[model samples]
Each structure stands twice: as C-alpha cells, then as structure tokens.
Target: MVRAGLMRIARLRVTLAYGAMLLVVTSALATLDPLARERIVEKASTNLHNLAHGHFGTLLGSAFVVDAGAIAVWLPNLLCLLALAELLWGSTRLVVAFMVGHVGATLLVAAGLIAAVKEGWTSTDITRATDVGVSYGAMAVLGAMTAALPRRWQALWIGWWIGVGAAVVATGGDFTDAGHGLALVLGALVATRFGAPEPWTRWRLGMLAVASWFGFAMVVSTTAALVPATSCGLLCALVGGLASRLSALRTRPTPSATDMVPDFERHALS
Candidate 1:
C-alpha cells in the first residue's frame, strides 16, 4: 500500500511540474506591455483579423512576444498538457514519448516556417503556432494505451490522428500539417520502442539526448535566428531531456507472467 501511494504521489508531481511551469510563464507574460502582448498575438495567429477578438483574446492576454516577434510565450501551456499526459501513461514510457514527439514536432514546424519565409508566404514578424497544441501528446498517450487495450481498438488512434488533422485544416492559416504528421509518426515509434524494458545503457540515453538537443537547437535557431529564442529552446530541451533520461533509467524490467500472477492475487485479495 505504501509503495502504491508513493508511486501515485510521484505521478502527481510530474503532472504538477508541467502545470506549474505553464502557469508561471503565462502569468509573467500577462504582465507585459499591452502593445507587446498584441504583437505576440498577431504573430501567433495567422487569421488574426478574421477570428473574433474574443476567440484568442484570453490566450493573447496571457502571452508575450519576444525578440522582434520570433518566439511567443505559450510553451508552458503546451508543456503542462504534455506533462499531465505523461503522468497518466506512467512516467517511463510517457516521458520518452514526449521528448520524441515534441522534438520531432518542433523540427517539422521549423522546416515549414523556413519554407514559408523563403517563399514569401509569411513574414519574419509572424511565428507559426498551429502545431504547438497538446492534442498530439494526447494522441500519443492514447496510442500507448492502445497497446494494453483490445486490438480492435487500435484503429481508434488512427481516427484520433485524422481528427487532429482535420482540426488543423479547419484552423488553417499558416498551419503546418507536416509537423503534426511527423510528431505522430515519431510518437508511435518511441512508444513501440519503449513498450518493453531493455538494457539501460548510458550510450543509448546519451545518443537520444544528443539527437533531441540537436533537433531542439535547429528549431530555435531557425525560428528567429536570434539569441533569445535559441536560448529558450536550449533550456527547455536540457531540462526536459534530463527528466526524460532519468525516468528511462528508472524503468523496471518487464515482469514475467508468473511475476504478474502474485501481484494480481495480492491486489485482488486486498
């Protein structure tokens, strides 16, 4: 019983950490100058003029745009949702999934932004915010859960992805569908890889960390080619990567069927 309680508490801590970070960042941005806030909203929304002021007014009211409209302040919200999802799916698997999904998504978004800028479809003043939602993380969580669920339910994950894709289309402006698709693929791959416990080698963790950081850096550097944006991405990647690696290190070996029976009986008796 004590062990179970401790495990629950640990899961709650991860969820709260993500949520707290979002709250802090959003709250701080809300205190920024009104003009700065407006500029950030403008950069975040491609259809700002078409969408009612109230539609994104709340988000804009709590966001800040930094470094000439290169990076906007909504990361906390995204991270909070991701963390909550991670907690729900158990720390080990979800953390790995989040890292892969986030980095992969960011890279795709950066690529789209770069292409848009080159084609003169979007200005340097605009930052794309379409693919930064928590829906992808939620989808990944659902995907991982499907492994435990009946096989017939496997198609549900695909349906969820399609729904998200449609949502992106409906909200289209400078949205990047490529980013969403890439994230789903990466999330699924990570989920499949980490589904079973394997040897925890420092080299494997280090390689993943390096790749994750490199991808994060590319996203930051390409977004604005500015110091602040790059700095933010670097910091996020470092902290997030460390947390993920630690969780992976702590992953227990998969139990055999015999090992599971006693635990099931104990729980059933309890």
Candidate 2:
C-alpha cells in the first residue's frame, strides 16, 4: 500500500506529461519537410489574422509550435521550470499562470501593434508577421515560481527577470520582447492570488498598477473610434491622477503617539 501510494503521487505530476507531449510534438515537427513544417507553424500562428479577427481558437494551437530554432533551449527550460512550478503550486495553478501569461501577453502585444498601426508608426504589413512560440508560457511559469520561493530567493529571482526584461525592452522594442515582458508581468500578477504572502508584497501591487495602466491604454487605443479623443485623454488623466492619489495614501506617514495630543488633556483644557 505504501509503494502504491507513492506511485500514485508520482503519476500525478502534470509537468512530466506536458513536457513529454511538447518533446514529442516538437520532434515530429522536426522530422517533417521544411516547407510542411513552415506551413504548419504559419497556420498555427496567432498573428493579425487570428488576433485582430477574433479567431482566438488558434491561441492554443499556436502554443504547440516550439519554434524549431529555440526547441533545444526552450524545451529543457520548459520542462524544468514547469516541473518546479507544478511541484510547488500543483497542476491547476500552474496551468492558470501559464495560460494567463501566454494569452494575456499575446493579446497585449496584438493590441499594441494595432495601436501602432492606427498611429502609422508601423507598416500595416507588420500585422501579418508570424508570432508563434512557447517562450511566453515558459517565462510565465518561471515568473510565477518566484512567489513560491522564500522571500530572499524570491527577490533575487524576480529582480533578475525584471532586469533582463527591462534590458531587452530597452535594447529592442520588438514584438517578441514586448510579449516576453508582458508575460512576466502577467505571471507575477496572476500568481499572487495563489502562493504569495498575505498583505500583498510591493511587487504584487506594482504588477497591479502596471496591469491597470496597460489595460486602460489597450482599451482606449482599441476603441479609438467609439471613444472620443477628448474623453480618452480625460480617462487617462483620471486614471493617472487616481494612481497618484493612491500612491500618496500608501506612502503618507502616520502620526506617532508623541506627535498627537492626548484626548484626556484636550478634554481637560476644554
């Protein structure tokens, strides 16, 4: 009975199954003719056609394509990071973090691209660019793992990720890097509800602020036709003003006992 119980527990690891499937599919794709593999990846992509057109069905399909060039590197990391996340957070939470990171980053990127197109900063043809890979999901899982670690370790891991992401964004504001940074933020945000300490850490609240700003920008930009520019500008101003007020509330110093008059002394004076 003891042996059977241990075996059952071992079998419950979702990461192994997911990793095996990833490897198998990646291997199969590698064996296919180059053109065939390319066609498959293209069809699975969540580019302008799938995202802007609301064909979200392709989102899951696109995650299966591991990007042939990145398979050796991404596959190992996925297995390790996902396995560790699953070990800490269980299967369901890991899946949620991964999906939130992958889907949220993809949508955010698509929205930004659409906004850029409307603003005429990027060529309209850029929308058709292929966007398929597993890094977003991997990075998301990796990000969530920070909340599962000890506080000291968490700081180091999260800081390293943020620093790298910022460096990447600073150097190259490409779609992939944008998606990566967004994925990390989404991962950290989503995982807070699951494993993070109570009272919410500074990083957790910071993620919320970032998310709120990003969401506001995305909604306004996407609905530029429906919302007047004046109204949108006012909305942005309101959100920024509110955020500043909240920050002030959080940062304002509280009075100490010595800084306040005793109620008894005031009553006696009156």
Candidate 3:
C-alpha cells in the first residue's frame, strides 16, 4: 500500500513541482516584513497600471505569488485541480491549459478594462486593484475538467460554471471575477481538443489522493480550533491505504488455473 501510494504520488511530477515552487515563494514572502511583502505583491499585480506600463512579465510572475493571507486556501486549491489536470493530460498539456487560461483571460480582462475606462464607464481607482494569484489558472484547469464527467453531469457542470460567472459579471463583481469567468470559458474550449473523458477507473487514484489530502487538511485545521474537533485523518489514511492496496491487487497478474491449486495437494500428489 505504501509503495503504491508513493508510486501514485511520483506520477504527479508536474503537480508536485508546481506546488513546491508556490510553497517556496510563499514561505520566502512570509519571512519578509509586512510592508515589504505588500510592496512586492503590489508590484506583481497584473492590474491595469502594470498592464498599461507594458509590464507583461507580471502575467507570468503574478501566478507564482499570492497574498500572505490567502496562501493556505489557494495552495491546496491549486494542487488538487492542477494535479488532476496533469494526471489526465500529462505535464506538457497541463502547462498548455494553465497558460491559456491564465494569460489569455488576463489579457482579455485588461483589454476590457482599458476599453471601459476610455469610454468613461468606471473609476480610475480600479486600475490599481491587486490581481495576483493562481486562481485564474486554477479555474481554467477546473473548467477543462468538465470533460472528465459523465455527459449529463458535464452539461450541468458547464452550465453552473458559466451561469455563476455571468451572474457575477452582470451584478458588477470585481474585474477579477470577469477574468475568472473568461478563464473558465477558454478552458472549456480547450477541452474540446481533448474530446472524450478517460476511463472511469483511471480516476480512482486521483479521488483517493484528493480525499486523503482534504481529510488531512481538515484534521489539521479542525484540531487547531478553540475547542475539540473531529479528526478524520486516521479514517482517510485507512481509506487511502485500502484503496492503494486494492489498486495494486487489481493490477496483479491473475494466476493460471494449474497454479491456483492448493500447494499442499499439488506437492502431496507429486
């Protein structure tokens, strides 16, 4: 079981590396003085000011940083979605999905904002909004994942995604919301290239890994609370172990009928 789990983890090379990179950057950011961290984060923002100045590098740089306060949530979120995409589509394809979703949507949003401001539709303060995080890329991967669902569920999932995004845009949500929405759309379009979902059984390991991670995270979070809380980490670990073992068993070559005979009977007769 342990070996199987390790092997499964090893297959997620791109996902783990990206997560580690984020962790390194975030840990370094946390060590800085609060004001210094804020300044760096502001500079990394892909907001209108940065975009207008043609600091296009922020488009790539901003994905590597997150607000100190948001690291916990965004890190896990990035891992699960991005890892699944990597597992399903391989490293190169995952990179393609992330870049398309992140860079494409960001540019689109900036263009919209530029047009909006020029037409006297909004305040200039918006240009300075902080827009650093991996969520746009995350959303793109998430949107593309719709391809993995059953057909009925796929339609429902896509509708819910787009409906929620459009609703947010209509109600005057932050420009980031629009970026997120556009990323999802772009990701879904990318999914068209991938066509049908992979086999259902192929995802068992992914579900097991995701469940174990979330369960462990939940236990850690809940245990740190004001009062005692349920710790399901043990349960999750058990489930993951069982799942890993079962997967190994299923893949083991079947014994021939002659080889299946009781060892004692076969030896005694001989």
Q: What is the C-alpha lDDT of each candidate?
A: 0.47, 0.67, 0.72
| Window of ten residues with lowest summed lDDT in model 1 | 61-70
Would you give me the overall lDDT of model 2? 0.67
Worst 10 residues of 3 by lDDT: 225-234
Taking the tens digit of each residue's C-alpha lDDT, what string does model 1 give over 145-178? Answer: 3343233433443444444443443444134444
User: What are the RMSDs of all candidates, in order?
Assistant: 17.4, 11.0, 12.8
**TM-scores, all models, native as reference:** 0.46, 0.68, 0.71
Better of 1 and 2 by TM-score: 2
lDDT of 3 by residue, 1-270 (tens): 999999888878888988999999999998999899989999999999998898889999998997736677657755876767777777777787888989999999989989998899988888998988876777777777777666545555555555555544455557877787788888878987875554565564576356334422322232232122122323333554566567768988999976988999889878
Better of 1 and 3 by TM-score: 3
Q: Could you tell me the TM-score of candidate 1?
A: 0.46
CA lDDT, candidate 3, residue 86: 71
